[model samples]
Target: MELRDYLRILHRNWILILALTVLGGAGAYGYSLLQTPTYEASTQLYVSVRSESSGVSELAQGTNFARQAVVSFVDVVDSALVLDRVIDDLNLNESAQQLAKTIDASSPTNSVIISIKASNPNAEMAASIANSVGTNFANVVVNQLEKPDGNAASLVKVETIEPALVPTSPAAPHTAVNIVLGIILGLGLGLGFAVLRSILDTRIHSLHDIEAATDSPVLGGIALDPDAKKRPLIVHADPRNPRAESFRSLRTNLQFIDVDGASRSFVVSSAGPGEGKSTTTANLAIALAETGARVALVDGDLRLPRVADYMGIEGGVGLTDVLIGRAELVDVLQPWGTGRLFVLPSGRTPPNPSELLGSQAMQRTLEALAEAFDYVLVDAPPLLLVTDAAVVSRFTSGVLMVAASGTTKKPQLTAAVEKLNAIGSRLFGVIVTMLPAKGPDSYGYGAYSYSVQEESVSPSGRGERRARRSKTEET
Candidate 1:
């Protein structure tokens, strides 16, 4: 994917990512609160060797010996030999092995100093344990290990250099660091999930998906309306609505389809049911009629018809009657609204819809209507469900496919297109409906309003000025 694709995914799922990050941080903080606070204290011991010679070389030798011996003494500080004495001195309740687990010993490289650190729940107890371990280790080495003969002075001496102090804060629960790490981990997981979901989802949610699926140019996109079912005739009922404006845009785009002045008849169909193909056909016809063009909207779907109901016209006799020679085209065609639009509703449900639509009579009816009207829009059944749409498409200029955003799948659309190709039918273009108004993949058109001032000559030969309100688009 490109950088823009990743950015769009992030924009679409930002709330999920943010929610997971906050939950991770809160969980880390809660874990920290449940842990026992631990305090650490450290003490340093200095080791030195005595020599009888007063020469500089002899003193250097003694220093080297003490440095080597201090390395070994570091391990002895955490041993049972010292920890057992510490337990006895402090009267602790734990065993020597358990107590040794709380102590740590280390020495700097080539140094005669050994550092002993101890940890406990109590700060004072931590300090006392570190100091006791240091004092006991010194006594064991001087009075027993290094003592030469009875009553003789010891050759090695271990002195307390830096005593351990009680730490003010605990080291185990690094609350701030843990919270930051948790947030980073959560963010990684959330981004991974978002990308995976985008890849796995097959539904078309944006114009980009439609473009990637087919080579057909997108005429226009209609924003989803909550009241679409109640007011399907948006171009007639509410002409200023944004959804209505989108139909006008579709109509404008449709004009360029037949630039050479060929037949302007088009079959409006979808891959599946409920994709807004019927409503789109009715609205586009109304939009074209508003521009003073003669448009005939036909209900070609013999199985089910909706153009008559949406157009608020009589549906007792229409396309089926005309095709069967029961009624003439002029008698069944009903004019709608104040425009030059006409509606030819499906007369009755036929037992053989595919056969009737593909018959020669159907082609003659479309040819007659195409010659009479500037534009003829035939609302057909879903192409994937039956052969009616593909059959009728042969009689018109081409098929106009309607895809619903986030509802139509890529495989379904591809199959629909393949069905048309199998029958040698032309697909004019694609119309995307039910698009979101806001988001990374929303419709890009913005609503705009402007004022136009006009000057007219009055009867007395005086100029009169008037201001008119007009909107280019509405949402």
Candidate 2:
């Protein structure tokens, strides 16, 4: 992934990352608190051969002897042999092997200096162990080199520069270092998880996501109408609203999307219920009708009809009534006052809705509607719930899928698309609805400028238009 992708993931999952980091730090701190305190003590010893009134040969020999013996002495201090004597003299609780674990010995490079260090639970015990090991090693070396002469035979002498002191603080457990390491590890792990999850998520949320998924051009995004509840007839009550503008844009795009195919009917539906399919169809039909072309709005979902409610008309007779020969076309046809927009409600809920919507009568009705109207906007049932949408989509010009933002699952959407594709329905595009507005980066005030202008003019313009009509009638 690119840097921005990783950044977005971090932004989206900051809480998870923070929790893990804090948990790691807390765990390290708890471990540090439970640990026993240990103190370290170290002593520096100078190892050199003692010489008489020196000759050049004697001085060179003494330096060579010191170099060779220093390594041996370091080994001896680290071994069980030297530690056994020291432990016995100090009356230590640990055995020779156990004491070796607490002791460390090292010799400086090109120098006759040796450092001995030891750690113990008590500071005084640590100091005593360091001092005893250095003093005992020196005594053993002197005795081994001694000979029966008036002057002692050539031997090495160990001189103490700094005596071991009881250390106040332990060195094994560094609280800050441990905590920092834990945080780094935890952060790394959390980021890996976030990246993996992002890679696996295939749900379409934005136009960018759809483009990336299907390599299709996103002509425009239709925002969920904020006043959809109060004003259902967006194109009529608020013709200049942004949502109305969006439907008009969709209508225009539809003109180009099917350039080669027959100019025909279109199916508007969703993967699930409450995705604004009926409202979109109603508004789109009105907008299309405003272009001075005949537009027919058909409610294909006979199970749960909403077109009549949106058009503020009766739904007792519509497509079902016409299909069963109970009513004629003119009896159910209701013109929506101004434009060429016409309403075809769902009529009555039928027990055999699936069979009726998929029958030859439904096809004949669509053919008749297509011949008379420039656009046939059919509102069908959700594809996931029933096969009515898929069946109707097969005979229509194309299908426009409506998806609710932040609520639609990727799997459910993919399944719906697959079902439509299996039946050979031409999938046009997806509409994302119910997206949140008030955010730092969202559809800005610029998008709603037309709506604001229309709202301001509607109040005054309505009164003027009414007065003009009244004056014309009186004259």
lDDT of 1 by residue, 157-256 (tens): 9999999998989877888998998888888888988899899988988877987888989999999998999999988898767788788888888888
What does the lDDT read for residue 246 in candidate 1?
82
Question: Candidate 1, residue 426: CA error in Å?
Answer: 2.0
Clashing residue pairs in candidate 2 are none
lDDT for model 1 comes to 0.88
In model 1, the Cα lDDT at residue 172 comes to 76
Clashing pairs in 1: none
Candidates in order, TM-scores: namely: 0.89, 0.75
Q: Report, for every candidate in turn, its global Cα lDDT versus the true structure.
A: 0.88, 0.77
Model 2 has a clash total of 0
- Per-residue lDDT of 1-475 in model 2, one digit per residue for the tens? 5676667678666878888888888888788888888889999998888778589889888888888888878888867767878978988777888998999999877778899999988889999999999888777766653333566564677888889998988876788988998888788878888778777776555444554544335544566566788898777897656666667777787667763344568898888898888888888788788888898899999888888998898988899998888988767988996758888888989899988888888888888888888888899999999999998886788788877765566777778888888888888887666644432112222144321112234655662222111111100
